[model samples]
Target: MSGLRVIPTRRRGQDLLYVCGTDGRNVAWYDREAARVHLFSEDLRQDVLDALGPFLAGAVTVGPPPVPTAAELVRLALHPDDDLAPNRPGEALLIALDRDPGPAHRLRTDPRRRELAAEQTVGEALDGLEGGGWRTLHSIPLPGGDRVHHLVIGPGGLFAMYALAARRQRVVVTDPLVTTGRREPWPLLRRVRSDAARASYALTAEVRPALVLVEPARLDVTGPPREVRVLTPADVPALARLGGVLKPADVEALYAVARDRRTWGKG
Candidate 1:
């Protein structure tokens, strides 16, 4: 007990202090967000508390961890390599940039960097909805070198969202075609719907498609896209206001299935 160490770590933007024994096995962990110290054993309760004395703030709960839910059990059973929960926004691009950063000095900024920024902005917004009973997964890799920028599940139902880096450009949407600034129109909505369809196939559930434009100067929709929902970064939080399509348990179940890398591989 004298050799117990308190190690600090961060997970999902939350601070955690882990109390480890001399053998480096975790005896307890303090979740700052929950203001609780989860103990692995009752016998070591006082020892764990003593080890965390310097870090303890106000009143805090000291007890065994709660029973794992079915979703949590599934998540726990997954191998680290197969877990998609840890992926940050634009994870693939982040990896690629890390592998080859290209010329140190560039004539113009990398388009990938702009795409990454857009994903991060939208990803952070989606992640904020977690407290309101939503679950989001970022940078889900599909077969054929494609990816779903973000997958969101909540009372609003499931949506596969694609982030566009429109920045200060005007965006025009006409069916499957999308035009940004002076750029030529492309069938972007087709890809958005296709990604959603793949997600639906993989999860065996209804997955809607959404296009999120980041910081577009203006958005014009000549005619609403068939089945795709168009939005901007500021509009993401509105999804939390939607309900009746799913229950909390359903959201967790779908999230558990979706976070497995194998789930997308089959699609």
Candidate 2:
């Protein structure tokens, strides 16, 4: 995973934590004074959680839990259908769950849990920009049933941001195609396409799509894969800077339309 840099800045008289991903992406400008830590991931061990709270350059507040998936909920309910029989889709998970449910649940939800941590980390940074010429609407439910982790409007143009915690993995990006270290590519790319269409239609405008691959071991990006920008969490700060400072009125109008959950689907 890429590292983070906490650059200090003051916006509108608010002491802010301007955090950046390794790739110089604009992660968020957090309100150092107002952000209360809320640990959102169970996958993170207590020790890790304890250390993570200092990002605001202070104590970390164990925040609420992260958003979960259908599989997660099913597993949590111990639904019989969630069984992990060998040779099936989640055979290993099933077996592990059978042998011992605790470890298995942790393993299965680890990736998603990391995603939550990333979102929460970034979300706190974003709070400072909430009314300071930037606006964000997160966990937007789409007609396709998947959610957009963050839909942002600011001095920069519109953006559809996705967060994935695929650390220690390699991803090869080529236009119209992507090959990951594990070689599984469909789900990630497919979601990017769907998100682009949803955001575009909802705002009646083109929305740039970006993927924030958490801390990948290596990313060999030859070109924009399928017109989507593959980025690391560290690149968030720069990504935000790319907007070149759009007008406040435009930002407000975009936020108003984009905030309407229905606009996302109708478009």
Q: Largest lDDT belongs to which candidate?
A: 1
Over 1-267, each residue of candidate 2 has an lDDT whose tens digit, in order, gives 236565665544666554444644333334456664322123333533334446646554443322334454443442333221112222233344566545554535644455666665555444446555777776666665576767767877677877666567787766545665776655566667667656764554446677767667888877556557777655666645555545666676566555554454543
Strongest candidate by TM-score: 1
Shift in Å, residue 77, candidate 2: 37
| Candidate 2 deviation (Cα RMSD) | 20.0
lDDT of 1 by residue, 1-267 (tens): 578899997654778897876744566789888899987567888999998999998999998554447667655568889999999999998999999888989999999999999999999989999998999999999999999999999998889999999999999999989999999999999999889877875765568899999999999999889889999888999998999777777787788888999888756
Residue pairs that clash (backbone atoms under 3 angstroms), model 1: none
Give the residue spans of candidate 1 off by over 4 A. Answer: 1-76
List lDDT for all candidates, in order: 0.87, 0.55
Could you tell me every candidate's TM-score relative to the true structure? 0.72, 0.54
Alpha-carbon error at 236 in model 2, in Å? Answer: 1.1
What lDDT does model 1 reach?
0.87
